[model samples]
Target chain A: MRIVIAEDAAVIRDGLSLLLTTRGHQVAAAVGDATALCAAVAEYGPDVAVVDVRMPPTHTDEGLRAAIRLRRDHPGLGVLVFSQHIETRYAAQLLAEGSHGVGYLLKDRVSEVGDFLNTLVRIAAGETVLDPEVVTQIMGASRRTEALRTLTARERAVLAMMAEGRSNSAIATALSLSYGSVEKHVTQIFTKLGLPPSQSDHRRVLAVLRYLES
Target chain B: MSFRVLLAAPARKRAWYELGYALVSLPIAAVGLIYLLVMLLTAATAATFVGVPMLAAGVLGARALGAVDRGVARALLGVEVPVPPPFRPRPGLIGWLGSALGDGAGWRAAAYRLGKPPVAVLASGTAASLWGSGLVLLSCPIWWRIPALAHLPVNTWPRALLAGTAGAVLLLLAPWTVRAALLPDRLLVRALLGPTRASARIHELETTRAQAVDDSATALRRIERDLHDGTQARLVALAMSLSMLKDELAETGRDDRLDQARVLVDLAHRNAREALVELRDLVRGIHPAVLDEGLETALATLAATSSLPVDLQVDLPRRPSAAVETIAYFCTAELLANAARHGGARQAGIELRTRNRLLRLRVRDDGAGGAAMGLGTGLRGLADRVRVVDGTLKISSPPGGPTVVTVELPLHP
Candidate 1:
């Protein structure tokens, strides 16, 4: 994997560079602010770019805007927005252009190194990935609460994982269940929530997220 | 008494100013008295068509003269009186006539002008006679040596000696007489020339409200910067270090790297602890935990850790409201810090007392005493904070000694 990192904090930026490089991933460029992030991504054409939502010169949404612009300018390049906070409006804006090749996760998720790396790889593979915190927030505030309430606890868990853009195998591993039973829970969630059952991980994410948002 | 002490009135500039003010008032008063009499005569027939406009013109003229008198008092008497609000007459003739006729400040000025002539005459007469007689008699011995006055009977040695002694006595009394004569004019000018009480209060609140807003904004920005650059960054670093440690541990069969992983764990632990400490300080900056235990305890805690030795005394009949308590606490904190930093003080004192439903906090320091408001030393900011609650801040810091700052807040604000 080839990557570019943009974070204002020098410690986090260097740690990320070291973490990816030691894991056999190429860190093409590691910059500190949004403008340099743009220039680096354009120069390196890395497969995926990890960007912090708060960067220099106002430290308020420059990274989010830069990521949005980068996605527009380079359709094939993937973007994973990493931030200390989960602003629901930011998630909505990032997911507005169809949830492919995009990821949004909290800065704390980096402590779970394997999970963080898996999210990055999924993003690079043209898959949508969302932090569980973001998914939980969306579920809490979802307009389809009546439909959501019809599902059992296990089926709701499957739906939340699906909204987080997890494949059945990943959901099965996280829930300590067999892949076949995870598939059964996914089918039950679809029927209960009145969503069309989708087989592929990418389609499943889109359907679940769209249903929750609507 | 020494002759120099007796003649001190002539040597001092204040005596001359009083004499000058008294001399000028006579002519100014004569003109003013004539105009006032005519205005009074016109006011008697106010039922007529032209009576109201004439009265308005007369009142406006008196207001102009009042401005002149205020300037004279400020320049000669060193009296500071704030400028009054102007006549806010509406547009069109009838609107203008109504407002002008009803203008309170104009009527007050007219009354001042009407009552000035008698006091001016008395003041000028006393100043002239006292200073004149004193100087002439004091110089009798010297002018007696002149050939023109040598043959005069009063020029004899004993008579001259008597005149000189009387002159010395009169000279000693001149300053007091002049000050006494000018007192009425000063009172009349101050009472009539300055802004009305309500207007002055409103203007003061407007100014302090702006300063309070700016102070709060600056404080919020500082907090944001602290969290962003301190605690948040520290936590992120701690997490990154822990993640690195986890990765190192996950790699098996590496005995040499075990020590490195242990070192990483130690570093992460230190970062986590430091982050917690930074967060605690930030929380305290927002609102101290000790405040919940009541203001007295909070102040005691503050005084205990002050850079300079602080003597804390709190005497409250009852507790002030939370808002007043917060203002009082922050005011004491800032003042104590200032006493240590800019004041370069050896010791400080904080005294809190509540009387007549007002909370008063007095902070004093035995330091170089030139602390002042509007000097960008946080004193002005503290004053603004106090005034936001309709409170007051007073500073009595004479050069070369102790600086004392007093802040008073309403107990129910």
Candidate 2:
């Protein structure tokens, strides 16, 4: 995998580069701030860019905005926004157009090396990935919506995992259910929410997000 | 007591200003008396409904006159009086009349106008007589040959010299008379035209409160930056180094000292993770980043994270000043925390609305009650904090199962 890292903190930037390099992924470029992140991504066209939310100049959501622009300019390139905190508004905005090839995760997730690497790989494959915390917060915000009230506890759990951009099998494994049962729950959620079933995981995630956000 | 004061430059300038001020006051006083009479007549006939608008207009006119008086005092007497808050009439004619009639400042100004005539008479009367008589008597010797003063009383040289000496004495006493006469007018203007003592205190409190609020906000930002750049950065680096070390030890496949080194690294990594969590929480407590979005979003986020189920509602005509919003946000945050920690609440509700130029936040909870302002530092601190902006926090909780807290704040600080 080829990657570019955009972070203001020198320690984190250096550590990220070293970690990805040691894992045999190519580090094409690493820059600080949003403008340079855009320039590097445009130049290198890396498979994935790990960007921080707070960067130089006005260190408030600069990287998130830059990632939004990158998603517009280079649809194929993946952007995984890393921030110290999770804001649902920012998450909603990043997923405004679509959830495909985009990810928003907290910086603390980096310490969990295996999970973070999996998320990077999943994002590079044009899959939608969100931090579990982000999913939890979104669910909390939308818990009062009429559409969400019909789901059973187990079904709601399945919905949460799905919202985190998990595959059917991954949901089954995480929830300790068989593949057939996960499929059934997913169908039930889609039918109950009045969403047309789709073959693509990206569309399924986008539909679920649109429902929750609405 | 100093004789030099009679000849001092400042005293001489002040004496001239006092004389001019006294002279100008009489005409102002006459106009003020007319305004006063009109106001009183309109107020007396207020039951006929013809006086309402008249009374409002009269009050407004007096305020205008007061403003001019304030300017005069400032220019001549070097006394600065701050302008009070403007009269904001509500919608409709009745509302306008009510606000105008209820304006304490305007009424005080009218009273000042009505009261000025007597003060002006005394001041201008004494000053004019002293200066006029002194000049006339001093020039009597020169004008003695004139027919106006051609009497037998001043026909000899000694009498003429005696009249001239008396004139000199009178002239020497004129400045003192003028100074004494103007003192009461100065005092009256300071008391009437300036802000009332209570309003002045409020103004001072408002200024200091704004300063305190801004200072805390800046300090919180600094702390967050320091943690972000110093402790959190170093901890992340340490964790990364340990992870690398653990990987290296595993790769080396050495039996000797490998287990010990791995255990130490694992402990260090765990501590690093814990430190990061604590630091994140500290930063959030100092100032939530979500607050930048606005109070509604920030409160929603707070509700989402609360241990108790929270139902939040926010209705605002517009955003308040940043300092005001920040103070309100912290108050809500502390109250919610208190509800969970001390009250053992299962459900909580927060409602924010603006009415009558006031921002009101009501927080209710279904919990074991008996909450008092002095029971905990949280409530006490919040009360003090809100008081900075002339806001009030009221708590009503008996030894029961429900508690309600309401905070009222000015829309702008």
Candidate 3:
């Protein structure tokens, strides 16, 4: 995959670049801060941009804000926003305009290299991927909603996994269930939450996320 | 000494100015006295509805009189008295009336006004007599030649010369007498009409203390960011590199030295992760970014992350100043940590609200309650931090069961 890296920390930035290069992925551009990230994205037009939530020049959500802008200006470009801590409000905001080609994850998730790379690949392929921590926080907040209260524990788990942008097959593998059973749980969750049934996984994730956030 | 005294005598122009000020003050003082008398009468009859408004108006009038006197002193005597702080009336009519009636500056001004008339009379009388007698006696020789002085006692040249000499002495002393008389008046105006020296110093300290509080908050935030973007980031990178090396070593499929390399990499990774966690905690302790959202959200985050089940309740009508909010948030965080660590708390409750412009936080724990502030520097440090804004901290714990810690802070520094 062609990627652009925007991070203020030199060690993290260089390490990430080296890691991606060793894996045979093209790192088109690497820069620091939001302004340079935007310029690099425009100049390189990479397949995806990996952004840290906090960057130089007001290290509070500069990367998150730049990612949002990138999503708006270059709708086809994928953005994966990573942060040390998961802020539910930032998650809600990032997913506000539907979850296509967007990802929000904890930086700690990078420890699991294979899974993190898979998430990046999924996001670059125009899919939504949210960290499990984000899903848990949103679930904790949405447990009080009437729609969520009606779900069984099993169905709620399926819905949370769905909100994390897991496909039915992946959900089956995680839960040790058949694909058909995972499909049934997804359908039941959509029906219970009064969301329109959709065949697209990205749209399904968005619908589940919107319900949970509501 | 006498020659030096003559040379250092108060300037004639300044003496004239003082005389003018003393003469002009009498009528103003009389009017101020009448106004104060009416105010007092109205206050005495304040049970009647009409007198209440009258009394309020009287207090305002007294303050205005003080302002006029301050202006006069500044313009004539070159004595500058700083204006006192204005009355801060509350929202309702009753609050306004109460504050107005209780205004310290207004009462002081009234007292100054009442006392001014006597001082003015004395000063003006002495000035008039000194100038008049000095002028008459200095022309004694000329007056003795006139027919009016021919039958008077001062008809001889030697006597006339003696009178003239005495007159010269009196003229030299007139300026000094005028200055001496006006010195007490200047002190009175400064004491009554201006903010006292102690209160002025207090105001200055309050401003600087508020700045210090804000500067410390900014500095802590900077430190947290520096650690987040510097040390923590570097540690995470180190862990990732170790992970990559571990992967590379495993992929080579050489079993002889692979196990040793794997163990070393594992140790490095674990240490890096541990360091990252410690740095993360240190950053959070310095200043939580969630606090920028508000005290409620910050406290909620703290409660959510606690080891024990925390019942959190926040009922604030308005947010406090940034410095005050930071202090309150840290106070609660420290207290919660204390409860969980030392108190053996099974469950904790945090309650926050604002009352009478004070932000109040209460942290209670159902624990073995023998906590004393003197037991550790944590509580003492928090108390000192609270005192920066003139806030208070109170703790109550008996040996057996429950502990409750309360903190009260002003909405502003």
Native contacts retained, all candidates in order:
0.32, 0.25, 0.30
TM-score order of candidates, top first: 2, 3, 1
User: Tens digit of lDDT per residue, candidate 3, span A93-137?
Assistant: 788865778999877666556677888899999999988888887
Put down candidate 1 lDDT per residue, B95-129, tens digits, no spaces.
Answer: 77888888777888888887788889889999889
Candidate topping lDDT: 3
TM-score of 3: 0.76
Per-model interface RMSD values are 15.4, 3.3, 4.5
Each candidate's lDDT (Cα)? 0.81, 0.82, 0.83
Docking class of 2: acceptable
TM-scores of chain A across candidates: 0.97, 0.94, 0.93
Calculate DockQ per candidate and list them.
0.18, 0.36, 0.32
Error of 2 at B116 (Å): 3.8
| A1-214 per-residue lDDT for model 1 (tens digits) | 9999999888788888888988899999999999999999989999999999878797667899999999999998999998765655678789887777999987767766767888899999999998887788777656566687888899888888988889999999999999999988887887778788778787787788778766
Give the Å error, residue A156, model 3: 3.7
Q: List, residue by residue over B1-413, the lDDT tens digit for candidate 3.
A: 57876855645567778878877777777787788788888889988989888888788788888999999999989997877876666536888888888887888888897788777777777777777788789889888889865887888999999999888778888877877777778888988898778767777888898888888878887887777877778787888888788778778876757888888888887887777767766776778878866889888877765666789999987889888999988888888888878878788999998876678899999999988877873999999989989899999989875999999988876
DockQ-best of 2 and 3: 2
lDDT of 2 by residue, B188-299 (tens): 7777777788887877876887787767777877778788766777677777777777777778876758888888888887888788788888887777777766788888
Error of 3 at A57 (Å): 3.4
Q: Roughly what TM-score does model 1 have, to 2 decimal places?
A: 0.55
Would you give me the overall lDDT of model 2?
0.82
List of clashing residue pairs for candidate 2: none
